[model samples]
Target: MSEKFKITITTTLTLVEQFQSTLSSSQTNAGQRPNPSTNEQNKDLDPLALLSASATALKSHVTKLSLLTLTSPFTASAVATTLSTLNASVLPSLVTAALLVTPDSHTAAFQSEIRVLTNTALKELFFLVREIQAVAEAKASKKSLDQSEKDTVTLAAGRVWDACDVVIDVATKGVVGFVVRRAEEYRDLVRDAVEEIEEWDPDEDGDEFFDELLDDDNEDRPTSGDSDDDDEDSEEAAAALRARKKDTLRVLKPIAQIYPAIITNRLKLVPVPLVPSDVKVLESLMRNLQQIPEHIDEVAGALYEEDLQKYTSQVGKTKDCASRAINLVVLPWAAKQSSGDQETVGDKFTTWSKTWIKVMGEVSKSIDKT
Candidate 1:
C-alpha cells in the first residue's frame, strides 16, 4: 500500500478498536460531562433520526470501500476518505445518540437494543474494513486477486448492508414498539412450553411398564422362593409409583395453562413511557417474566422423573415468581391511584393472582396424595 493509504487504514482501525473497547467496558458515558445547554438542545435532536442518518452514512462508506478496483488510480484515496469519515464522524455520533436516550429508564431496554444493533453494524463495518485492508495489501504485493478474495469482500459488504438495514428498521420501531415486540417474543416462548407439556406422554417411553413386566417375570422364577407377601408388596409399590406419575402430570397441565395468561396480562398492564421511578420494579417484573419458560421446564422435568418433592419445590418457586410479578405491576399502579381506585386495581390483580396460586396449589395436593 502507498504510505498515505497505510497511514489512513492504521488510524481508522485504531479508532474503531478504541471505540469498541470503550463500548465493551461500559464506558460510553465516561467522558460525557453534563452540558445543560447541550442537553437542552439535544431535547429536540431526535436520536432515531441521528441513528438513521448515521446508518445511511456508514452504508455509503461500505459501498465505496467495496467498489474499490485494483486498476483504479483513485482506489487508495477512496479507501482512505471512506475510512476517515466512518471512524472520525459517523460511528461516534451514532453511539452518542444511542446512549443519549438510554437514561430514560422506561425505554432503557429498547435503547439498549439500539446500542446492540449499532454495535452489530459496527462489527460488520470493522470486518469490511479488514477485508478492504487485505485487498490493499494484495494490490501492494502485486498479487493477483483470486475469485475467493473478491467474493469475500463482496460478502463482507453485503453483511454490512444487512446490519445497517436492521439498525434502521429497529430505530424506526422506536421504544414502545420494541418493548411490545419483546413481550411477544416472551409470549411465544411460554406458549411453546405449554405445547410441549400438552404433547408430552409419560407412558410413551414405556420404561416403567417394561420394568414392571421384567420384575413380574423375575418374581415368577422364584430363585430364592420369596413369599407371596413380598410379591404383593412389590406390585403395590409399582402401582403407587404409576399413580403418582399420573397425578403429577395432571397438576402440571393446569399450571402450564397459566403462563400464557400471565404474559398476556403483563403486556396489557405495562405502561408506555413508563414512570421513571417505577423502573426498578418493572425490571424485576420483566426478569420474572423472562424466567417463566425455564421454570416451566424445571417443573416439567421434575414431574417426568416422578420426583414429587422436587416437583413441589419447583412449583412453589414458579408460583412465587408469578405472584411477585403481578404484585410488581398492580402495587405500583395502585399506589399512584386514589383509595377507591387502588381497591379496584388491587381486586383485579388479586383475582388473577388467586387463580395462579390455585393452579399451583394442585402440585401440593398431588404431592400429599402421592
Candidate 2:
C-alpha cells in the first residue's frame, strides 16, 4: 500500500489564496510545464498555494493508472519509458499470474529467454514494480505504503511477470527482433545466427513478407523471381523451407552455446531460483541438440560434395567442443581439490586429451557416416 495524497493547510489561505485549486488526477503523463519563474502567479493567489495544489494533482494521476489498467487502454504511449526505468534489485513475489497453455515453439523460446534473465535482472524487475506502486500510493495517501498495501503490492509483482510472459510469447514466433531491441542488448558473441538471419530474405519472388521477417540491413542481390509458373509451387516450398531452417537455427544457436557451460557447470552451473521450469527448458534445449545431427547430415551432404574439406573440418570442431565439455565436467573435481603437483594446467590438458579420445568414439562415427 502507498500513501494517500493529502495536504495540510498549515498556512492561511490569504498567504496562498490561489492554491486552493481543483484536483483531477488521471493516468496521463505530466507533460511539459511552464517555468515556475515565468508562469505568472495569479495576483490574488498566495505563493504558498502552488505547492500543495500540485501535490494533489500528482496523486490523482497515480490512482487513475492503477484503477484503469484492465479497462482503460493506456493512451499514454510512452509509459513504456517509465516501465523501462524500473530499478532491478527488488525480488518479486513468485505467485502465478495465469496458467497459460501455449505452443511449444513459444513455450521453448520463452523458457530460454526466462532462463537467461540474470538473477539481478529478475530481482530488479520485481522490485521496480513495487517502487512504482509505492510512489503512486505515496502521492495519493500522504503516507507510506502499509501492510495491506504490502500485500496489495503482490498485485504489482504479478503484473510485471505478465509483461515478461507477453515478451516471451511474442519472441517464440521469431519476434526476437523487436523484443531484443527493446528489452536489452544481448552479448555480442551470443547473437551470431540471429545477426545473420536478420539480414536474410526467404521469398524467390521478392515479396516483402519474406523480405522483412527480421530487422537488419537487407542484401539487395536478386532472387529467382523468374522461376516458371509450372515450377513456382516447388520453388515457393523450397524458399519457405530455407527461411524456416535458417531462422530456427538462429533461434536455437545461442541456446546451444550455453548448454556446455550450464550442464558441465564449468562456470559453476548453479540452479536458478525462479522455478522448476528452468530445468524443463534445459531439457528441451538438449532434445533440440540431439536433433542437430539430423540437420548436420543434410547440410553436410550439401556442402561435402562441393567442399569435402569444409564439411570434414566442421565435424571436427563439433566433436572437439563436445569432448572438451565432457572432459572438463568430469575433471573440475581435480581443479576443486588440487592435491600437490598433480593439479597443474599442463597435467589437466594431458588428461583431457586422453579422456576425449576414449569417450567421443561415436563422434567420429557420425562424422564418418556423413
Candidate 3:
C-alpha cells in the first residue's frame, strides 16, 4: 500500500508541474512581441518590420498552444486568455495603418517590404482567429472543465472572435477602397485623354484636304451641272476622313493601354480571405477590368484599321460579356444563402461595371470613327 501511494503522488506532482509550466508560458507570451531582430539598422528604416516580426512570434505561440491543448485540456484557458489579450492589443492597429497607406506613396524597395509585412500580418491574424475558435470548441467538450468554467471559456472565445471580425472588416475595406479609388482615377485619366484627342483636328484637316486633294483651281464649283468637280470634292473629303482616323488611332492606343494596367496592379494589392461577397464582386470586377486591355489590343492590331466597324461590334460583344458576368455570376452570388443582408449588390457591383462598359463603348466608338 505504501509503494502504490508513492507512485500516485509522483504522477500527480508531474502533471501539476506540466500544467504550471504551460500556464506560465501563456502568461509570458501574452506580453511578448512576435519576434525581435538584432540588426537595428534594418528596423530603423522599416518601422513595420518589428510589428510584423512580433505577429509571427505571437502566431507561433498560439499555434503551439492550439496543438498542446488537444491533450492537455487545462491549457485551453491559457490559450483563450492569450488570444483575447492579442485581439485587444496594438498589433491589429499597426496592421490596419500599414494597409491603409497606398503602395505608390512609398519607394519601390519599401513598397515590396511593406507588402510582405502586410501579407504576413494578415495571415497571422487569420491563423489566430482559427486557433481561438478551436480553443472554444475544445473547452466546450473538455471533461476537466466544470459547467461554469466551460461557459466562461465559451464567452471569452466569443468576444475574441468578435474582435477578430472587426479587425478583418476594417482591413478589407481599407485595402479594397484604396484599390477602387485608384482604378477610378485611372478611368478619369483615360476619359480626359480621349476627350483631348477628339477635340484635336475636329474637321480632319478640312483645309489641307481642299488644298492637296481637290483641284486647286476649283475652289468653288459651278452650281450648274458640273458633275466631275463635285465627285472630285467628295473623294477628297473621304480621303481626309480616313487620314484623320489613322492619326487618331496612333495617338490614343498608348493612352488606352494605361487604364487597365494600372487597375490590374492596384487590384492585385488587395489582401486575401476577403468577405465572400467582396471576393465575388472584386473577382468579377477584375475580370471585366482586364477585358479593357484585351479589347484595346484588338483595336490596336494591324487589321483593326482596315475594318474599324468589325472591332466596334467586338466592343459591343465585350460589353455583353461584362453584363452576363454580372447577371450570371455576381448577382447570383450576392443573392446566395451566404450573402446575408447586403442588398445593395447592384450598386456595389453591377452599376460599377455598367459604368465601365459605357466608358469602353464610348472609347470604341471614338476609335471606330477613326
Candidate 4:
C-alpha cells in the first residue's frame, strides 16, 4: 500500500475513535446540565438552525461516502474530514442546543428527542465510516469488492442518510412545531380509539376479548353468562351490559372529541417568550392530555369484556385527566391576568374550561349511577 493511503487510514480511524468517545459523553450528559444564562451574544445563536445546518452537512458527507469506489484513494481522507467536522462542530452545537433547552421543562422532552435522533444519525455515520474503512482496506490488499461487501456499504450509507434526514426534519420544525405535531399525533390516537371502541363487537370477536385479557392479567375473566345461570339472569346481565356500553360511549366520545380542541386552545394561550413556570404548566398540560387516550383504550377494553367495575374506573381516570388538563390551562391563564382585567381577559378560557369540567362532572355522576 502507498504511504499516503496508510497515513489516511490511520488518521481516519483515529478521528472516528475520538468522535465516538465525544458522542458517548454528550449522550451521557444530555438534558442533565444546567442551562446557561442567555446574553445578547447568545441571542444570535439559534440552536435549531445550527442543528439543521449540522445535520444537513453530515448528510452531504454521508452521500459522498456512499458514492466512494472501493479502490478510491480519497476514502480515508474523506471519512476523516467528516469525523473532524462531527467532533469539532456538529456535536458541540448539539450539546449546546440540548443544554439551552434542558432548563425549560416544556422543551426538555423535545430537546431529548432531538438528541436521540442526532445520536442515532451519529451512530449510523460511525458505522458507515467503519464500513468504508473495511472497503478501503480490502482494496489496499488487492481484493475486488464482492456483492456482499458492496451491499453492506450501501445499506449502512442508506441508514445514515435516513437517520440524518430525521434529525434535519425535526430540527427544522423547532420546539413549538414539534409540540404541535406531537399533539396532533395524540389527537389522532384519540380519534382512532374512539372509532375502534364505537365499532367494537364483543359477540363477533369473543375470542379477542379473552385473549387480550389473558395477555394483560394472566387470568381469565367472565366473557358471558355462566353455565349455571338461568335464562332470566342472563337476560338481566345482557341488559346491564348494554346500559354500561351506552353510558361509556356517550361520555367518552365527546370527551375524546373535546380533548383535541382543548389542546389547540391551550397552544394558543401559551405565553410568548414563556417563563420557566409557564413551561412547567404547559408541560404538565400536555402530559395530562397525552394520557387521555391511554385511559380511553383501557375503558374500551373494559367495555368489551362488560367489566363494569373496570369500565367505571377507567372512565373516572379519563375524566380526571381531562379535568386536570383543563385546570392546567385555565389556572395559568387566570394567574397571568390583572385584578382589574382578570374577569374580562380570562373570561373566554374560564368559560371554556368550566363548560368542559361541568360536562365531565355530570357524565361522571351519571356513570356512577349506572
Cα lDDT tens digits for candidate 4, 85-143: 65576556655554444435336667668757766776786688678777877887865
Q: How would you order the candidates by TM-score, starting with the best?
A: 4, 1, 3, 2
CA error at residue 367 for candidate 1, angstroms = 5.4
Query: Tens digit of lDDT per residue, candidate 1, span 1-370?
Result: 6788889888877777776665554435533444677678786677787888888888887887888643344378777877778778988887767656554543446656776777788788778778888888777776568789889989999998999999888877665456557656766776676577666655454578887889788845654556576768767766766665566456545544544554455545556455665556656766776676678678778766767678767766765666676666654353554555654556555576666666666655756554
The collision pairs in model 4 are none
TM-score of each: 0.75, 0.27, 0.32, 0.78
- Candidate 2, run of 10 with poorest lDDT: 90-99
Q: How close is candidate 2 to the true structure, as a TM-score?
A: 0.27
**Steric collisions counted per model:** 0, 17, 2, 0
- State each model's CA lDDT, in order: 0.68, 0.36, 0.45, 0.69
Query: How far is each candidate from the true structure, as Cα RMSD in Å?
Result: 5.0, 20.0, 21.4, 6.0
**Candidate 1 clash pair list:** none
> Candidate 1, residue 34: CA error in Å?
9.5
Q: Looking at candidate 3, what is the lDDT of residue 303?
A: 33
Error of 1 at 6 (Å): 2.4
**Model 2 clashing-pair count:** 17
lDDT of 2 by residue, 300-355 (tens): 34342435455555445545444443444343433433554544533444465454
Comparing 3 and 4 by lDDT, which wins? 4
Q: Residue 353 error for model 1, in Å?
A: 6.2
